[model samples]
Target: MAGITGIGSGIDIDSIVKASVAAERAPKDAQLARLTTKTTTQITSLGSFKSALSEFQTAADGLNDASLFGTRKASSSDATRLTASAEKTALTGTYRVEVEQLASASKIASGSLTGDSNLAFASGGKLTIGLGADSFDVDVAAGATLKEVRDAINTQLNEKGISANIISDPANGTSQLVLSSNKTGAGNDLTLAASGADLQGLVTNRPAALSEAQNAKFKIDGLSLESATNAVSGAIEGVTFTLVKAEEGVSTTLTVGENTTAVKDSLKKFVDAYNKLITTTNSLTSFTKVGESGEPLTGALLGDSTVRNVLNGLRSELSNTAAGQGGDPFRALADLGITTQKDGKLAIDDTKLTAALEDNFDAVGSFITGDNGLMNRLSDRVDGYVKSGGVLEQRISGLQKTDADIKEQKADLETRVAAIQARLYSQYNAMDSLIGQLTRTSDSLGSALSNLPGVVRERS
Candidate 1:
């Protein structure tokens, strides 16, 4: 096939074979190309739709929580003195908080030592450190330096809430072993006991208290409260306030109120996500002019009933009243100023929406997050189409099978084309051989006639 195919026949046999094969392959190849393009387009369209649907569902689900509606905002009059945060259970009120004392951790330092001093402990020595009820023991080997003792205590007893460090004074050029408790509060102090002479000198016997362990003392609404740490919670229900600094008689006022801004922002996000989904679905199901030739181009999902059903279902759910809006005036999304536009997207009336949320927040929330609420209904419907083994997945799976079938057909057609080419080459070669034989016969007869003796005598 690679060499000169028509050399023996003096004919363009290669061109003939190519022409025959092309004629047979043209229709089948075109069909496969069209099918391939269609399947790929469908897959891409479905994937885009599913992605947009997923985002929309997530936004809707955020608003589906009841606690979000009851969100509370906490503010401190003097944040420098205190900082506060409130949960959904926190009631709206003002409280006077006075910080009596900020908690301090227990810190102890050992006697000074020379810089190059290499001190060793007695053999089989053990250092036992305790913090409240928790205790841990560190094994001390003979000839262990101050650094070694610090490292062993840190690496071995870290889980027991103890830290060890060797602090060096630059002016004196002396280092001492300092031990501190990881926790704060009265009774949560570090108590060290050692069996070796060196270990006892470092932790047990010769120790100076750098800072005393103390509890956080503060007053909440004229009621005194004490905590192990500055971060005090449960002193007031659903509220946690951190005591930054204590100024006697300087009280900070903390106010807890409804967080309407968060609710409004959440609603806006849901609207934006829903609009995006609508836009995506519209484009995928629309028709438009394709190119300069002015041919009409249909969308990949045009005339798809699955797309139509999903859109219709969502629209219906959005228009209906929520389940738990028994006597509330705002039962449907439309009541809260969310209405359907002519282009199938949702538009919000800011004035009405704001008034609805500000005037009757609880009622509005009930309408949207109730059992049969718009978000609940929409969430369920979208899940049916986008979830695994759902409508969109099934459609994509079918298109993939079509792709496989197209490949098989293409391979079979190629085999047929090759066989046809072989047949054409054989026929042309036989015809060329017959023509050569006839030409040879004619030359031989003409030579014999010219050599005849009678013809030569006549010419003289």
Candidate 2:
């Protein structure tokens, strides 16, 4: 196949073989090309479609929560003095809150010692400190300085809500060791006891406390209440009051009510997501023409039954009214001012939605998120197509398999074309060799006859 093929016959064997191979491979090559293009486009299109559906499903799931409706918003008239927060279980009402006192932590300072902070104590001993219901002991070494004692106390008891430090009064040439309790409340006061002369001096000769531990005392609606910490909870169901400062003679109003804004925002998000999904589907299935030639451009998913079915399923869910809302004023998304447009997109009526929520907030939740609700149904329907091993995945996988098959066919075609080209070249080379032999044989016979003295030679 690689020899000087056309020399004997004066024919282009390489060119002929190339043409035959092209002729043999053209049809299958074109078919495979078309198949590959189409299959790749469809896989990409289905991927886009699935992504859009997932977004819409996520939006639906977010709104399909019963707690969203039960959410409560709490506000305080004087947030500077008192701030309140409420959970879903909090009853909606107005209460007058008065912050009489805020809880404080205890701070005590030892009598000033006329020496450097690093001065050694008279003798080492066991020092005990108590906070709340917990206590710890620090063993001071025989020659421990004031700083060492402070360090040992801090190292041993810092995590227990107690700290010790030396307050150096350089102007008076004295240093006072101060102990403070981070734990607030009267019952959590810090107590100190020591066993050696130097340690006992710190405890027995302590000055008046800078501040005493006290519980926060406040009143809600003229009902007295006290809390060990300023952040008071459980006094009111599902409500927490953080007492910031004392307003003994004045009261701030605490307002607990339904969080309609959250519900409205969630509904708006769902509508937006649904509308976006519609837009995506429409684009993916659209067919249009462009340019002066008016060449038709088609979408990858055009005429696809899966796309049609998915859209129809979602539409059905959106249109149907949820059951079990017998006496409820709202039973569907339409009743809550969410309606479908002609183009299969959703539109919101802000005024109508606000009025609906204000009038029947609970019923609105029931219609959209309760048993057999629209969002729940829509979510379930979407799951059928988008979940693992679902319709979209199966279809895309089939298309991918088809694409793979096309590739294999193309490879097979290439191999066959190579064989055909080789065979054509071999046949052409053999014919050329035969022609060369015949010409050589004729020349030899003519020369022998001429030389044998009986052959006539004539000029044409």
* TM-score of each model, paired residue for residue: 0.82, 0.87
Error of 2 at 265 (Å): 3.7
| lDDT (10s digit) by residue, model 2, range 1-460 | 5767789888888888888888888888888889889999889989999999998999999999999998998899888998988999999899999989899999888777878778787678998887767788889988899999999988888888889999888798888788998888878877777888877767766888888999999998999988999998999899998999896879999998888889988888898888888888888899898987887898888898988988898888777765645787876678778898889899999999999887887888878886577788889989989999999999989998998898888888878887887788888899999998999899999888887866567767
Tell me the tens digit of each residue's lDDT in model 1 across 289-335.
Answer: 77878889888999989888888888878876644436778757888
TM-score of model 2 relative to the true fold?
A: 0.87
Which pairs clash (backbone N, Cα, C closer than 3 Å) in model 1?
none
Give me the candidate number with maximum TM-score: 2
Residue ranges of candidate 1 with Cα displaced over 4 Å: 2-4, 7-9, 67-80, 85-89, 112-144, 152-157, 169-175, 189-208, 257-269, 290-293, 321-326, 337-344, 347-361, 456-460
User: How does candidate 1 score on lDDT?
Assistant: 0.83
Task: Give the winner by lDDT.
Answer: 2
lDDT (CA) per prediction: 0.83, 0.86
lDDT of 2 at 211: 86
